[model samples]
Target: MAVGSASYLELLLASDTDVADFDEPLTQARAKGAPADQLAELERERALALRVREILIGHRRHQAELQLLNDTAHDLAALHDLDAVLQAISDRARRLLDCDLAYISLSDRDRGDSYIKAASGNISGLLRALRLPSGAGVGGMVARTGAPYSVLSYHEDKSIIHTAEIDRTVRAEKMVSLLGVPVVLGRHVIGVLLAAHREQRTFSGRDVNALSMLAAHAAVAIDNSRLLGEARAAADELRVANATTRSHAEDLERSAAVHERLTRLVLDGKGVEDVVQAAANSVAAGAWCW
Candidate 1:
């Protein structure tokens, strides 16, 4: 069947011509005699063509999405501010995943707490005040495990403990479902990416996969932004140091000029005692002595 389809497809492709040239010969062939075999062949060709068309359409759609994703990644990477990148990531995730809330939390290693760095939706104000201890919540678990996690029912999940403080915030914000993925950079787990729905919703595998991809991208962007910030800071320090060194050099040059002038005055018959007193004053004030 495959071989026959291939042959018929080849014939059909051969029959394809410019619309202007699609005249007598092709019409007569179709009208006078399309045998059962030829008709079958035509049907096979049509089916193959339809499949190819669908495949092409799917491929194009995928390419367009990829391009869009790449563009977004590039834009995010161009942002050197950590807060800006986090905000962009959260906003994009909320929009793309169609979630009610999105947020990013960074681990406060010293205090053993996770604090929300950026969030979307109505909970932004509340999330800003929420904090979770290490190993306390799902987001914390993801941070500790460096893996992605989800809870369909935040209140019902035994593995997820809801602290009274956090529960009040959650209830006030009307959050029901939760998804969290760790942001890993090298061997370090930097933070967590979270998405929540106000209603009970099962996050599909595809949704998890997409969030994982976004997390990976966000991790790199965050890391790069940090590195860039450090680089800029180092550069600013170096520039300041250079300027200070130059200022010192100029001061030394001026001091040397003053010494030359004083020595010339003394050599040209000024009073030695008076010249000495003047030179002492200049030297005390950062001028060179003769």
Candidate 2:
């Protein structure tokens, strides 16, 4: 029993072993004419080992999620371009979930639609710049609602309002399963991050939660990029305004000096030709008086 228990522990610790693999030692003991009660004891031990494996796997998954969040925060701090940020996000989501592809779609308020901005695992590139109306499909609906949603069949799912372009693109790519989470800011949904599969598959709750967390990070990046652009634009406008103000001030000073010089000539008993010549010179030199 001691040796068998140790072997069970070893099997549980093996990274590649599964629940079916845990039966090796018990099978061997049974072949050696082990008593019924002893076999039952081994069965109980196997059940315990499987439970331990579940807990261990779950803990590791949780740790990975925390690490991914930290990495995304680092990306936001280190990268400036929106395309770079979004590509990193989509790549990470695709790799983490083991999905066939992952992509990002941002809402365009002027056009009242969402368009794919970045993608990973997209071999054909047909969907890279595809446009979807605000309520046209899964990604668009998520953008409108600011919620996470998943579907097993993108083509057959009646819940999604399929548009001609979106449906055609998806069908051409043979995409089946999809999950989308909104990139939200305060009360508005600004975009969506999505994962897809080429075949029908259900998204687990954990998958939904994981994508939601990633979408939250994406939202932060989008908001930061927009704010930075707005700040730069405002700074540029302020610079132009300041330059124009300085130019007008210099013009006013020149006009005042020309007026004072002409007035002094009149008070000093100078001829009108001298004042007129001075006025002409000032006018020629771009002086203005009102």
Report per-prediction Cα RMSD to one decimal.
9.4, 1.8
Cα-based TM-score, every candidate: 0.72, 0.92
Candidate 2 C-alpha lDDT tens digits along 1-290: 78689998898778898778888989999999999989999989988888999999988988887787788778767988988988999988997777999999988889988789989888665798598887888997687677888888988889889988898888867789999998888888888999999998888888888888888888888888989999999999999999999998998899989989999999999999999999999988788655
Model 1 lDDT, full chain set: 0.76
| Deviation from native of the Cα of residue 173 in model 2, angstroms | 2.7
- RMSD value for candidate 2: 1.8
Q: What's each prediction's clash count? A: 0, 0
| Residue pairs with clashing backbones, model 2 | none
| Residue-level lDDT tens digits of model 1 in 29-84 | 46867667765655555566656655655566457546656867988867767788
Worst 10 residues of 2 by lDDT: 140-149
